[model samples]
Target chain A: MNLQLLAFMILSLVTLGAAFKVITARFITHAALYLALSFVGVAGLFLLLNADFLAAVQLLVYVGAITTMLIFAVMLSQVEEIRQGAAEEGFWRRILSARFGVIPLAVAAALAGVILYLYRFANWKAVPVAPDPNTTRSIGQAMFTTYLIPFEVASLVLLVAMIGAIVLTMKKEDRSR
Target chain B: MIPLFYVLVVSTLLFALGVYGALLSTNAIRILMSIEMILNAVNLNLVGFGRYITPSDPRGQIFAIFVMTVAAAEAAVGLAIILVIARRYGAAAIDRVRMLKG
Candidate 1:
């Protein structure tokens, strides 16, 4: 196998494994950490796909900002659960007692199977060529020129999110009503 | 060069995992995390297609950027809502927070 394929295999394995742990980990804090690892793996995949700008953004936004936010939220909200430990019922017992034992897994598997089967019929026009090495410059140029309106809209969305979060989480006494 | 098929497969698996997590988890935060994974899977597919199919145009990458931006915003607002629920209800589990039930 070539080096690129080898790297892709390893990266996908780590990504998928960590993603699984995010769902199954007993400790929610550990699950958040696993989620971060999965994000990093996706970033590596982005690099492999020659999306260097996206890879960096993935690391910065996902690993740096989003992970921190999640961890903080967990700590803020789950203080009691964290202190006492997530010592819930055994995994198998919980699964058995849930609404359906394996319905979720079966549904997910079915969806993936159908998508993959459909993929076989659709012939994609794939071109094997070297992509532009300087994706960051290209992305920046596009942001200002072709994607300026969308860019501004994204900024507006971020601003709205920030203000909404502050308003939602503010102390009731702090309300000026 | 890696085939686009493998990348698509990986993305599909990740999406499936996300779907399962979203379905099985009672914790609202975990559900939100699963949503993030789903978005990440979509981003991977976009980047993979961009690299192999349309290397000249950066639309796929741009779309991925937009996805990330929206995801970040979603995370912030979702967490804020979760915090409100947790503070009011003393837990963030979906089963526990049923006040909005119609």
Candidate 2:
């Protein structure tokens, strides 16, 4: 295999492996850490796609900010179950129970079936190559021009989310009293 | 050159995993993690399409960035709500939180 193909394979394998671990890990913190690793692997794939800017943002946001927030939430919540390492009956533990396991299996199977069907049928024709030097510059220009409004709106959404999160965490009785 | 088919198939599998985890996991935090996985799959698709279809322009990259931004916000709010839920109900498992089951 060429270097490009080899890199893609390695990055993708890393990404998928970490994602798989995220779901199956025994501890929530383990899952969160794996999530960070998964994000970094995806960033590497983005680098392969010549999306250097997107890769940077993925590292800064997904791998850094969100993973830290997840760890903090896991810490702050301090759930009794996870604190003592979940004695038993966690998600993986309960998978042996047919009643609980069947639904998720069915949901996943159905989704996979649909996606595979679409992939086989879709007449996708394009193949990507290495990006030219001006790709990022053009993107920046468009963001400030045609997409300026959407850019502003995205910032607004972030602001709303910030306020909403604060309100959601406030004491219920604080305003009621 | 890597076939786009490989990328699409991998993304589809990731999406399937996300859906499975979201539906099956009893832990609210795990569900959120799965949701993040789903979003990442979407980002991969967008980036692939952008790279192949419009190498000269990065409209697809911009869209992926937007998705990431939204994802960050969603994680912030979702975790805060989960924190509050765990605090109030003393239950990290979604199946036990019955305050809004109606």
TM-score for each model: 0.94, 0.92
Q: Kindly report which residue pairs in candidate 2 clash with one another.
A: none
CA lDDT of each candidate? 0.88, 0.84
- Candidate 1: tens digits of C-alpha lDDT, residues A31-130: 8999999999999999998899899999999999999998987876644653222454444566676464488878999999999998778799867676
Docking class of 2: medium
**What's model 2's lDDT at B35?**
100
Model 1 local distance difference test score:
0.88
Report the C-alpha lDDT of model 2 over A1-177, residue by residue, as the tens digit.
Answer: 499999998888989999988888888889999999999998998887778888988999998899998888787666775432244366565777787788888889898889889888889766445536566687799999999999999999999999999998887688697
Any residue pairs clashing in model 1, and if so which?
none
- For B19-84, candidate 1 gives per-residue lDDT tens digits of 998898777888899999999999999999888888977889999999999999999999899888
Q: Provide per-model DockQ scores.
A: 0.72, 0.69
lDDT of 2: 0.84
Local lDDT at A134 for model 2 = 65
> Where is the poorest 10-residue window by lDDT in model 1 chain A?
A82-91
